[model samples]
Target: MGEATDRSGGRDRFLDRLPWLLRWAVVGSACLLIVAAGVYVLARIAALLAPLTIALAATLFLAALLDPVANWLRRHRTPPALAALATLLLLLGLLVGAIVLVWRLTADQFSDLAKQLDQGLTRTRDFLTSALPISPGQLDEWTRRAVSGLRSSAPDPVTGAATVAEAAGALLLVLVLLFFLLKDGRPMWHWVLGRTSDRSRPMATHAGGAGWRTLGAYTRGTVMIAAIDAIGIGIALVILGVPLALPLAVITFLGGFVPIIGATVAGSVAVLVGLAAKGPTTALLVAAAVIAVQQLEGNLLEPLIMKRQVRLHPVVVLVAVTAGTLLGGIAGAFVSVPITAVVYNVLRTISEDRRAGAHAPTGAPADPPSRSGPGDATGVAGS
Candidate 1:
C-alpha cells in the first residue's frame, strides 16, 4: 500500500508538470501563429483598402459624431432618415454661412496681402542688390530660373487629374456612408449580434453599448470643446483687430478639431497674422492669449466634459496620439482618441462584469473555464 501511494503521488507530479509543459508549448505556438496571421491580414487589408481608407475613416467619424443629433431628432418625432438629412442640411447651411461671411470680411485683407507681397518682393530685391555681390541682372536671371524650375517640378497633369478624381470619389464615399450609417446604425449592430452565437450575444451587447456610449460622449465633448475654443479665439482675434479675423477664427475652430497639435498650428497662424497686420507687441499678446485659452480648454474644460466619457490616463492618450500620428498622419491623429475611448470602455465593461460576477452569491470565481491542471487547482484552492 505504501509503494502504491508513492507511485500515485509520482504519477500526479508528472501529470502536473506535463500540463504546464503542454500549456507553455501551446501558448508560445499560438502567439507566433497569431502574430504571423495578423501581419498577413494587415498587409492584405492595406493593399485592398488603401484607396478608400481615408474616405472610410472620415465617413465613420462623421457617422459617430452625427449619431447623437440623429438620436435627438428621433426623440423629437423625426424619422431616422429624415433626422439624418436634416442634420446634414443644418451642418451644410452652417458651413456655407461661415464660408460666405469669412470671404466677405476677408476680401480687403486679401487685397492688402497682394500689395504687401509685391512690396516685400521689391524690398527683398533692393536689399539683395545693396548687400549681395550679385548684380541686379544676375538676381533677375536667378529668379527666373527658380520660377522655371518650380514650374517644371510641378505635378504632371495626369497625376493631378488622378489625385482630384480620387479626392472627389473619397468625398462621395464618405457622404454616402454617413447617410447609411446614421440611418441604420442600430439595425447594423443588431445584425452583427445576430451573426454571432447566442452565448456571445450578451457580452457583445454590453461591449457594443459601452463602445457606442463612449464614442458618442467623446464626439459630442470634442465638438463642444472645439466650438468653445474657436469662439474664444475668434473673439480675442477680433478684439485685437487682427486682419482676416473671421477666416482666422474659422481656421482656429477647424484646427481645434484636430486635437492637441492642430490647436497649436492654428494659434501659430493667428500669431503670424498678428505679426503681419499689427506688430510684435500684438503678436506677443496673441500668442499669450492662445496659451491661456489652450490651458483653460485642456485643464478645465476637457476634464469636466470628458470625466465620464471613457476616462483615459494622460499617458494613454499621449501614447495613442503618438501611435496614431506615426501610422496615418493627420487622419490617424483625429481617429486615435475615439479608438482609444472605445477600447478603454470595452475593456472596462468586461472587467466590471468579471468583478461583479466574482462578487456574486455563487461561490465560483468569475474566470473562464480553465484548460490548465495543477495551476488552476492551486488558484481555486487559494481562492
Candidate 2:
C-alpha cells in the first residue's frame, strides 16, 4: 500500500508540474493529432472508393458552376427535371463542341507535332554538343539506350484497357450524379440543414453557404485565370512564330487546373518548342514571356478576380497538392487545394458565428438571413 501510494503520488506530481499554458499546449497538440488521424482514415476510405469519390467531388464543382443556370431556367417556368436536364445537355454540348473545335483546328498540325518534335530534338542535340563539353557519340549512345530500355519493357495491354475502362465508367457516373444534383440540389442542401439540431441549424446553414460560395468562386476564378494564361502563352508563341501554338495553349489551359506543377510544365513545353524550332535566343524570349505572364497572374489577376475569396498560401497549396497526389494520384492533386479551402472556410464561418453568438448582449440573430445575390452563391442554390 505504501509503495503504491508513493508511485501514485509521483505520477500526480509529474502531471502537476506542467504549467497551465503547457498543459493547454499539450491538449491542443493532442487535438491536432486526433484531427490528423481522422484525416488519414478518411483519405484511406476515399482511396478505396476512388471512382465514386472523384466523381462526387467533380460533380460538386460542376453543380456549383451550372446550378445557377438550372435555377434561372426554373424561374422561367421550366420544370425542375427539365431545367436540370437542359443544363446538363448544355454542359455536354459545350464540352463536345470544344473537343470538336480543337480537333478540327489542330488535326493537320498534330500530325506534324511528332515530326516537329523530332526535328526540335535534333537541333537541341546539335546545340547541346556545340555549347557543352558533351560528345555527339555520348548523346547518341544515351538516347539509344533509353529507347532500347523502353522497347524492352512494353506495358501490358490488359492494364491499359482496364485503366481506360475505369475512366469511362467514372465519366458516366459523373453525368448521372450531376443530373440528380442539379435537379434536387437545393432540396438536398435544405434536407441536410434540417437534419441538424434547431440550435445549430442557423450556424450550419451559414457555414454551408460560405463553403459553397468558396467552391463556386474557386472553380469560376480558376477557369478564368487558366483561360488568361492560355491566351497569354498562345499569343507569345504566335509572336515567336512557334508552330503548335494552339495545342500549346490548350495544354496551358488544362495545366492551369493543376496549379504550380501544371504551369511549370506548360512553360517548359513552350520553351522547349521555341528552342527546338527557333533558336536559343527565341527560347530565352519564350522563357521571359512565361515568367512575366505567371508573375502577372500571381500578383494582379488572382487578387482582382478572386477578391481575396479562395486564398491559400503557397506553402499550404504545395503541401495539399503533395498530400493529394500521394493519395489520389492526378485527381487527388486537382481536388486537394479546393477541398482544403472549402474546409477552412466552413470552419472559419462556424467559429465566427459561434463567437458572435457568445458575445451578443441580448436576443440577437447569430447569423443573418441569406440573400440571393452574387454574394449568396453556394455549392447548391434555389431559384
Candidate 3:
C-alpha cells in the first residue's frame, strides 16, 4: 500500500510537471476524440438499420408535433389510450383531407406540365441560339445526352419495387411507434429514469426535458415557417399567371419540410414552369419572388421564430445538413437539423446544471435537480 501510494504520487507529480495549457489541451482533445469515436459507432449502427432508424426518427418528429394535442385531451379527463387514438385519427383525417384537396386542385394542372416543359425548353433553346454561340443542334445534343444519362441511372423495376416495399414498411412502423409513444410517453420516461443511476438520473431527466421542449418548439416553428413560404410563393405564382400555380404551391409546401434544398428545388420547378408557360419575363419574376421569400424567411422569420429553441447559427445548420446528406442522403438531411437542435439544447442544459452545482454552497440544498420533473406529467417527451 505504501509503494502503491508512492507510485500514484509520482505519476501525479509527473502530470503536474506538464504545463497547464498543454495538459488541458491534451485532455480536451482526448475527450473530443472519444466523443467522435462513439458517434461514429452509433452512425454505423444506424446505417445498418437504415429503415428502422429513419422510421424511429420520423416517429419522434411526429410525436413531438402531436403530443400536445393528445395531452390536452388527457387533461380534459379523457383516458390516455382514448386520447392517443383520437389524436392519431384526427391527424390521419387532416392528412387525408389535405391530400384529397391538393389532388383535386392540381390534377388538371399536372396534366399540362409536360407541354409547358416543352415550350419552356424551346424558348430557352431559341434564346440561347440568338444570344450565345451555341447552335440549336448543339443544344439538342446536350438534351439527348442528359436524357440518356437519366435513363442509364434509372433503377431496374425489381429494385424500384423493393425500395417501395421498404418505404411502406417504414411508414407502418412510424405509425405504430407514434401511437405507443403518445399513449405512454410519461410512464415510459419514468421507467427510464428508474433504471438510470441515482447521480446521473437527475441530470438526464433535466436534459431530456429540455430536449423534448426544444424538439416541440422546432417542429411547430418549422411548420409555421413552411406555411408562410408556401403561401408567399403560391401567391406569387398565381399573380404571375403561372399555369400550374396551385400544383406548384402544393409542391412548395411539401418541399418546405426539407429546409434549404427543398425550398430551392420547389422554386426552381416553379421558375421552369413559368418559363415554359408564360415566357422569360414571367419566369424571371417567379425567380425574384422565390429569392425574396427565401431571404425573408432566412433573415426575419427563422430568427424571430426559431431563436428561442434552436439558437443555431446559419453556418452550423448548413454544415449539419451537408454532413447528413453526404453520410445518409435525403433522409439524413431531413432529420439532421432537429437532431442537432435537440442535442445542442440537451448539452446546454447539462452544462448549465453543472455550473450551478459547482457554484452552490455546501449544506445548501441544490435546486431540485430535475426542476422540470413535474412537466413530465404532460407527456411532452414522447419517445
The residue-by-residue lDDT of candidate 2 on 47-108, one tens digit each, is 99988999999898898788779878987899889999999999999999988987887787
TM-score of each: 0.74, 0.89, 0.91
User: Highest TM-score: which candidate?
Assistant: 3
Native-to-model Cα distance after best TM-score fit, residue 100 in candidate 1, in Å:
2.3
RMSD (CA, Å), each prediction: 9.9, 3.3, 2.5
Instruction: Point out the higher-scoring one by TM-score: 1 or 3.
Output: 3
Question: How should the candidates be ordered by TM-score, best one leading?
Answer: 3, 2, 1
In model 1, the Cα lDDT at residue 349 comes to 72
Backbone atom clashes (below 3 Å) for every candidate: 0, 1, 0
Model 2 residue 128 lDDT?
A: 92
Off by over 4 Å in 3: 1-25, 368-371, 379-383
Q: List the residue pairs that clash in candidate 1.
A: none
lDDT at residue 380 of model 1 (Cα atoms): 10
Sliding window of 10 residues with minimal summed lDDT for model 3 = 374-383
| Model 1 CA deviation exceeding 4 Å by range | 1-48, 116-156, 363-383
Model 3 alpha-carbon miss at residue 41, Å: 1.7
1-383, model 3: which lDDT tens digit per residue? Answer: 99999999999999999999999999999999999899888878888999999999888888888988987888889888888889889989998998898788878876877887778778877977888999889989998999999999999999999999999999889888888999888878888788889888878888888888888888888888888998999999988878767778878887876778889999999998888787788989999999999999988998888857676776887898887887788888888888899999899888988888888899884574545551466436442
